[model samples]
Target: MMPSATRTDARESGVIGLGFATLWRGIREQPRLFALAASGACLYTLTGVASSIVLGEATERIVLPAVRDGHADWPAVAVAAAVIVGVGALRALGMFVRRLAGGTVVFRVQGHYRHRVTRQYLRLPLSWHQRHSTGTLLSNANADVEAAWNPLMPLPFAVGALIMLVTALALLFATDPVLALIGLVVFPTFGWVNLWYGRRVWPLYAGVQRLRGEVSAVAHESFDGALVVKALGREEEETDRFRVHAEELRDAMIRAGRLRGLFDPLMESLPNLGILLVLIVGAVRIRSGAIDVGQLVRVAYLFTLLAFPLRAFGWVFGDLPRAVVGYQRVEAVLTAPSEEPQGTRNLTGPGPAALRLAAVSYAYPDASPDGTAALPGTAAPAGTASPDGASQDDAAGPSARSERPVLSEVSVEVAPGSIVAITGRTGAGKSTLAGMLARLVDPTDGAVLLDGVDLRDLAPGEVSRAVALVPQQAFLFDDTVRANITLGLDVSTEAVWAALRSAQADRFVAALPAGLDTHVGERGTSLSGGQRQRVCLARALVRAPRLLVLDDATASVDPRVEGAILAGLRENAGASTVVVVAQRRSTIALADEVVHLDAGRVIGCGRHVDLLASSPRYAALLTAYEQAARAAGTDAMPDPDLATEAVS
Candidate 1:
């Protein structure tokens, strides 16, 4: 959601100057193209005015003479008709250039800003993402960008309308003083009516744009949680939730439409009145011998031609409110503070990177400045627990819900090539600690180091090359298995197979119809849960990272397959430092040493057997986990998040 202060400011900033200024900025950004479009618009306007003049000349010189003399002036009529056709051809050419160049300007500006927004998305910290929903971000990058540039399509037309209005006014005055007076009144009235319409419609348009995002958000929420909704029989509830946002959007659009309808006629009638008044006064002027039939026809025709040109301003202003809101929304993303600055230095090592956490204390970026907890998705990470033994998509929750560092000041070290288990009940900050190992997030206070060098000091891509963090939720792109594993890396087929073997995913992959070439579909939906987890593991393994942080990465895999992967990793122990967020007793037993965390502090560290005998909380949590597994009548590990919630 946008901040109330920002939205209020937008509502207060009326559409007149702001809309014009916004349109000017876009034109300025793509000057060359807008110049072409403007040039075309000017040509179109000039030719249109010329056509009216030519027609009036035909009436005065050829038609009137033929009627008066009772003879046909075929030669002169041919000449007049040729001139009109020539003017129209030029007008058509101008319209073509205006449309083509104007379209180019819009797409280029939109594409430029869309790239900027998405790049900013990647550069921002996870904490920032938490504050915004996926739907809102999508709206910002896609819908908002397009909306921000919507006015550009009509901008050149508006620019040319100004020229047309000025030229028409001058030509009318030159034609007859009485007719010029009508132009003066009609044009300003058109502007005034549009101005009135803009002021009243801005807030409504802004409301419609804002609710567009909300509707998208609700629809995304329903779609993303479809399985849960269906299982819980909450389809009607989700539909109602979506309908509320949809109805708000519908109401806002209707209000805007109604407002436009009420004012359109007034704007439309001003030009009609100009023509009507011209005809009325024009007859009087002709009878008085002050103006001839040619001049009267010219003045009235100019007014008729200018009806649309005057309303061109109306077109631009009509789109202005939505454009302003969208531009402001996009600006918010572009100007948002970025993540921790990267360093120029790179880590150099062939062996595993040693690990260190020096009094690490991490508070989410969106947490209160005073260190007070925020809502579930902001101050705390987002994840949930399933009633089943395993989490369907669980990561961590707002367990402790503290604005203070989830992982309080405490220090630990891990030797290179050693496997260490970071165990805690739920929200004891185990996942937070695991994230530190991979620098997915930086600490609020203190530091995490690798090989005696602070992680922050390493240049961008250095940390990624040296470390790989595999979360419980396995993400796979829609591509071949080989493509997912290599991920554009120039790894050979042999190496891919090697990583697959190590991850214990070789057998199933080889059994596929196309082997490594088999398409995984989106998020690997074609594969079973365990197969996806193993493939993700293979992806990490292929990198040959020096540090591997598995944050409950094996939750979906069976115990046998998990053991095989752990065993294979053990065989290659000296190549990478392994940090596992452990829950199962078997996993804890294999670690070189166990780091038992309780309430964000390391309560015990040593062999798992030693911790069981010493730390009561550790023993109770594991005891609860094992008993729950037994009660479920399966070897599946109970969700650590659920266990921790119970213990805490």
Candidate 2:
């Protein structure tokens, strides 16, 4: 959770600072373009005022005089006509340039912010990602960014309105101070109406934006779980859930619309009222000989000219609040602190890398109120907080006094070129230890080292090159099998084939119509569970990592295939260290040594036979593994005593 002061600052700054920050960024991104756009807007405003002045002069000095004198002032008429045409053409040009430049600025700003948000997403840790949904993040990058910049689209027009208002007011006062005084009432009244509308509509618009994200999240979950919904005949339930959010969004929009509906009439009517007031004052002034009829006509025209620009004033103020809210939402994601400090040391000369965990302990971050801290593959009801009043995804702060450590004060070491099996019962920290050795999550208490250097001290890329972790669940992109295996690596086809052969995946892959070129559907949905696991194994093998950690990576495969894969790895054991987290006796039989874990503590370490002889917990866990393998109808289940004696 963010500190109360920080959150309050965000909300307070959101009212104005966020909008200006966006404007500043736009200016910084394209200073020359923004300047040109502002210039064009000013020119457009000037032209509009010039048109009003031309009309006033034509009515006063030329048309009225021509009628009274019974002869046309052809020169004056011609000059007025030329002026009108020139100003109109220039106004059109100004509109074009303003739009072109303003649009360039808006789009460039949108794109830059989108790129920054995505980069931030990538830089954030997986734990951070778990707290946010895919739908919410997507909305942040797209809809929120669009809403934040909505004011920019009308910004130039609003600027023009300001300039036109100033110029027209100056001209009006010059014609008749009394009429100008009446006309000025419209400016403040127009502002008041907008202020009223803004205060009403801003909260509604904020609700609408939040509901939009909720609606998107629900829809995304439905689509991603479409198969489950259909299979379980829960389509109607999903539809009802979607309908609830949609209705909320609809109601919010309608409320905002009603407020705008009331405000629009007032905004439009105030300027017309000012025009009437100005005309009445002008009529009185003319009769008293305080101003000429021509001057009175000019005053009328200026007041009338204000009508259009005043409407633009309403638009700017009305949209301003919503844009501010949107910008604040986007800023939250961009400003989140990254998970861990980066390292500067690089790995060198890594052959069969050594690995160690020194007094390591880990605990999941305190859960968020919304259950965001739940482990991957576990589902918690929305809006539910843990007993400790923390979200499932919340990281325990450095100053937190107590922790529920997943691996408590446990230490282990693997020599170069050794195959070590880590065995544990469910929730016994097998997977957690694998994650630490692979550097997926840092320990809460101690350090992980590779080749005598703390893993935290190694550069990010160094860790990637030195270790590969193939998790239980395999994820492949929607690309060719070859592409998924190589993943932009500059590996040759031969190396790819060799890796596939080592994982026992080449035979199945070769049978496909395009062989390595065959495209796998998203998440490898087109492949069988075992095939997907094998492909994932191949992906890791192609990297030829110095340290390979497999967390039940072959669980979906048959025992025969698992045995073959293990044998292949053992044949090349000198090239890399292997750490296998297993619950299968067949897999355990291949390890040079075994570390038995129970309830987050390492109970024993030795060859399988020695552990069985020494540790009762180790014996019980191995016996359970054998019984489960037999129940699953595995082709080969180890003979109980024979397995113990073979290691001996």
Candidate 3:
């Protein structure tokens, strides 16, 4: 378990730091975009204010002359035409820059978010990933990042609008203070309404996003299990469940739409009401000769232009709550506390130190829905700490000390170059033990030591170089056979084929049409279960790590394929520690010694013949494996003595 004090501090600091760092990267990387947007906003506001002033002056100069003295000025008319053309040209440039800059910023921010999320995923622990759905992570990386840019898109236009409105109001105040003050009164009310609506919409949008994730998950699961769903004839049931989530999402959208429908019309009316009041008072002033007719015309036009932006300002604020909520949701994932805090550590090379587990234990996380208790350190079935070092209480939180004994007071040492096979029943913590060896999870009580140094003391890269675990469910990317085989190593084409040959995967791969270039499809769905496992096995072998961990890696392959792969591995064996979690009597027969586990405890350890004679649990486990293999259509059972003698 991670230390409570350290993990808490790091989690808090990391989330804030990562968020700000990403924000800084956006600004630094897009300086030109920022400049374009700022320049565009400046030009837009300047054009609006200049147009209003020029129009007002032109009207007073020409219309008043014609009305009072029966004379028209051609020069004033020409000047007004020039102002109109200049303002139109500036507004066009403003629109071009705003669109271009907004797009550039959104793209850059999305790229940054995708890269950071990928890095975070690689660094987070296996247990952390186990608890989260892949769909939610995908949504955070793709959808949430895109939505976060909503507020940013309207910023330049909003700023330009505000500047134009302020200038227009100042000009109006110069002519008539009473009308200007009345026009501004509606703004406070608009701000209050915006605040109220923004608060109400945030939670709804968050709920919608959550429902969207669920819908995606359901769709993904349905597609992945289409065969099972069809075979079970539950298509209608599945469809109904999907519809429930979809309808929930639709209803949320409708509610949000209704809110906007009410707000938008109200927003439109606010400015129009202000316009009516401004025009009425201005006409009175004009009649009293307190303001000129030209000035009154200018104020009215400017107020109308202000209407577009004021309404835009409301929208910008309206979208802000949703955008902020999206940002926070993404931040929660990107900034989550890691199971292991990463540092700058590099795995150097193959070292001669052996692996030693000294009094280690572990427990399942409290948040797991399955209530699967961990190894040594969890409360015993009797609800008390066992003398062997199992915990007496339940594990607490993310940073809690493990209470279940996933492994307790258990100490083992693997001599360099030896093969140690762990034999156990289905729930005997064999996989958990293998995980500990690979540093996938830290122990609760003692520590796993490499050579004389604690495993944690070695750099992570070094630890990775030392150990590798090929899990039961072997996974591959949607790529070619060569890519999957060479995934773990920085190797040439020759090296890749060599590893494949050693893992006995070279024959089938060579038979494919594209050979090394054959695309594997998603998770190697194009390949059989056994072929996928071989490819994963080849991946581990390619790296040539000092310690090779096989957690039932051969369980999926045919007995013939398994035998051939094991033969190849044994021929090349040297000083590497090979730990196999076995369910096959044939697989166990290859071990230098077999360790038997029962209820998370190692009850017996010895050579196969010795265990068969001395340990009933080991005999029972072997009998079960043989029975399972027979049921699966394999006619042969492994001869314990013959198989043991062959590998040894």
Candidate 4:
């Protein structure tokens, strides 16, 4: 569904130059579509020209004779009627072919563009995804692509108008060059008018498109947060906000509509001015015997037919500027560089996965406007700047002067078949560390290794298979529970059930009316928070990943359910390497080893009890977690043996 050639940007070459080039490219991409449309246009022009010629002859030969002789030749009359009918049938056939061709072209173009956009989304880096909204992406994929066809629909008809104009001028010149010249004068005037209209209209169209994206995004957000809004009783406020946006959109569209309404009537009338001038001059010519009555009648009829074509021509001129803007927007998404590059190869061996991060560091692109600082807490040191005065990592302020590093030149290791829990305060870069392991973003320096191979060396799919992530917010597709659990895998029902059991989701899933076949709804809205978390856990377990990373994935589940899930994981997935970024002390205490993180540095790494004894930071974190749990009364301490066995 992609057009091969894009519309040209007219700013550089002037409107006509760029518009024609862009059109030529679009036609070139789908030659068959263009050919079919062009062929139909040719037939349409031929039908008009033929009708004019036959009707003109009919006026002179038969009508005049009938008025004088009082009887008509029956056979000649039948022949003329039959020929007109035949020409009309051919014109109808041309229309049918063009309709089919135009539809196919438009459908294919939309499909191709959507596919390209989806592929781009998949290839882009995690950082890029962080900056875009679901609604903006949705509009580009659905609405804008469809709107693109409006400008294209009238293109073939305009071609037909051009052919008609040429043929009419030729006929007019033969009858009288002066009249021909008068008709030709409209062409340049039409060009100038279109130029003026295009300049004023394109910017307005772009503004409308931008506003449409924003409005769509807002609507999507509001819909997603409907429950929250209702809970807070903010519906009236939300309604007022939406009304403001709706009013803005209405105003923009009205401005565009006003321009169209003004220009369209004027364009239609301009052609009639040519007709009037031609007729005035023709009247003199006819009296001087320079042209006949039949020729004058034909010329007037031709101009009458031209009135409709002129309106279509005006539409084309009115929309070209907007179409170009739309094209450029779509092209920008298509042409943007992928936030992450594709790796060349994949890990070959199959065994327990081991993860190692060696001297890793990262920085944001815009943390410092002067290009000399790092993001807050991400700087290496005050004097630790590159030769260009930029920090190794980004800092928030004017220089590489942040007090702490986001991620220092630190090293860590997770052995095969181990469970390592990571604990940190809210903004301590724990999520960043997990992201590096998942290869969502590559390290700024050093490397992450899976079973002795650098992550960058592994193919994306291979890495996906090797590592599975369960983020804090788990997403479920709108499908049956079974489908969401297995995703794209071809695992048997028994295997799916086994994974669900292991993730402690089977109990609730079995209680549902449809069991595994129950619908999850959009993002699993039908499910409770705990149910959704369990389902996500089942999804990750179904993959049987060598490395499983959970970034506070069970935060919403009740303590008993969370503990049950952890126990199930230990029992069912004994040899898998597990990494958990946790806020709850019980979960961290259950892991074989605990890594205490603060200000993006690993302050302690050892068995939880050992770290509590050896590292004051570890003790403080555990104390804080316990105090919070006590304050919230989430749950009393479970069997102490549960924590001991998790560490054992």
Query: Best candidate, lDDT-wise?
Result: 1
Of 1 and 4, the candidate ahead on lDDT is 1
Residues forming the 10-long window of minimal summed lDDT in candidate 3:
375-384
11-125: candidate 1 lDDT, tens digit per residue: 5766677777777778888999999999999999888899989988999999899999999789998899899999999999989999999999999999999999999988876
Candidate 3: tens digits of C-alpha lDDT, residues 458-498: 76576787777888778899989988887645799887888
What would the TM-scores of all predictions be? Answer: 0.92, 0.87, 0.85, 0.88
Q: Which should have the higher lDDT, number 1 or number 2?
A: 1
Global lDDT scores for all candidate models: 0.81, 0.77, 0.70, 0.71
**Ten contiguous residues minimizing lDDT sum, candidate 1:** 372-381
Model 2 RMSD vs true structure: 5.4
Candidate 4 Cα errors over 4 Å, as ranges? 1-10, 367-405, 572-575, 636-648
- Candidate 2 weakest ten by summed lDDT: 385-394
Report RMSD (Å) for each prediction in the order shown. Answer: 3.9, 5.4, 7.2, 6.9
Candidate 2 overall Cα lDDT vs. reference? 0.77
lDDT of 1 at 307: 85
Q: Write the per-residue lDDT of candidate 2 for residues 1-648, one digit (tens) a residue.
A: 223553475467643454556656556877887777877887887888887778877888888888899999898788889989999999989888888998888898889889999998887765566566666777778888888876776677778878888888888778778788886677887876776676667677777777777787788889878999999999999999999989988998899889888888887898889878877877788889998877777677666667776776677667776776667667778888877667899877858988888999877666544443222111232433222222222223322314456678888889999999988766567777787787667788889989888988987678878898887778899999999999999999999999999999999999988999999888888899899999999999999999999988898888889999999898899989999987687898899999888767888988988888888878876776566556666644443334444433
Best-to-worst order by TM-score is 1, 4, 2, 3
Evaluated against the true structure, the overall lDDT of model 4 is 0.71
Using TM-score, give the best candidate's number.
Answer: 1
